[model samples]
Target: MNMTDSEKAAKVIEALKAAEGEPAQIALPILNGLVGLVQGGGEAPLEFEEARSGAFLAICEIGKALHRGQPADQLWAPAIAAAERWQALAR
Candidate 1:
């Protein structure tokens, strides 16, 4: 589905309210929403955009590790850190 930047930002904010669990284990929709805010069409700052990519890479790493039967913990530290960094930059 296609959505404007405003629509994506709105979705991200709305989802954030309902995503009050482990930061590492955040809902995929939240991550999707975030990607919407940072993609090629997005106007996010370089730092924010980079942080978004880092968060995604961390998630992918966790998935790969899990597929290999290795223990994975949300890629918690890296993902959460990237989130915090981007959030700060966005502000």
Candidate 2:
């Protein structure tokens, strides 16, 4: 079955949440709610740029958590590799 953009976005959010530690606790619930809204056929409150910015900020938080000895390397390392591959494709 094809997933909607919201579902894809939610998967990314979940991956970030798995890698993110304490710093992300506040934002994850809000993000998850937005995902739910999208899943339910409602518009997400954030615009595309806003969502992109938020995702970037969340990634940074995950990186910080990783730096602080959070045990998410197994989860995040492959993600980082995948990101690198996509970046390479864009180049």
Candidate 3:
């Protein structure tokens, strides 16, 4: 049975809630990979844009985890730091 995207996302969120240790360890590499694809600038600009959109969705999911009271230091510190650096670069 094929799950819809929302179902898949909900499953991932539930897994993250039950996860032990640093969730960032699992999440960051994926985010970094998406960012790399966006920044790499290959022939498939649309694919890169899709990757960038995925990265944004990942960031939102992380933020949702934070809002749901995941420990900031343990699960999300690196993500927060990376976001800060990105903001700094933008300014």
Candidate 4:
């Protein structure tokens, strides 16, 4: 999908605002809250961790594609920029 810079920026801003509450505290908590349906423990055998990892990769890829102006579905670089930004502020 073709996303203009302004549109992407707006979306990011909206997301930031929406997550301005406790959601901003921990990325893991946000993911778990969003997609917690896959929860499982050792005996039950659930792929929650894998699912979380995949979601992280997908978001990072989307951010990368947006930043690089690449085809959104083709490939996405890791979201190091966003991670660093969040990490610094989160600390």
In the order shown, the candidates' Cα RMSDs to the true structure are: 5.5, 11.8, 11.3, 15.6
Global Cα lDDT for candidate 1: 0.53
What would the TM-scores of all predictions be?
A: 0.51, 0.35, 0.31, 0.32
lDDT of 2 by residue, 1-91 (tens): 8665545555654555453444445534533443332232344345543444444444555555555656544544444443333233323
* Selected candidate, larger lDDT, 1 vs 3: 1
Give lDDT per model, in order: 0.53, 0.45, 0.43, 0.37
Expressed as tens digits, the lDDT of each residue in 17-89 for candidate 3 is: 4332445566544444333322323343454345434434545566556556565554344434433333333
For model 1, state the Cα shift of residue 77 in Å: 1.3
Per residue, candidate 4 scores C-alpha lDDT tens digits across 1-91 of: 7543233333433343343332223433433333222222234113433433443455555544444555543322233233333233323
Candidate 3 versus truth, CA RMSD in Å, comes to: 11.3
lDDT of 1 by residue, 1-91 (tens): 8865445434444444444343434544455445545454557667657866665576456545545656556454665565555555555
Clashing pairs in 3: none
Runs in model 1 with CA error above 4 Å?
1-41
Candidate 4's TM-score reads 0.32
lDDT sort, best first: 1, 2, 3, 4
- Which consecutive 10 residues in model 4 have the weakest lDDT in total? 36-45
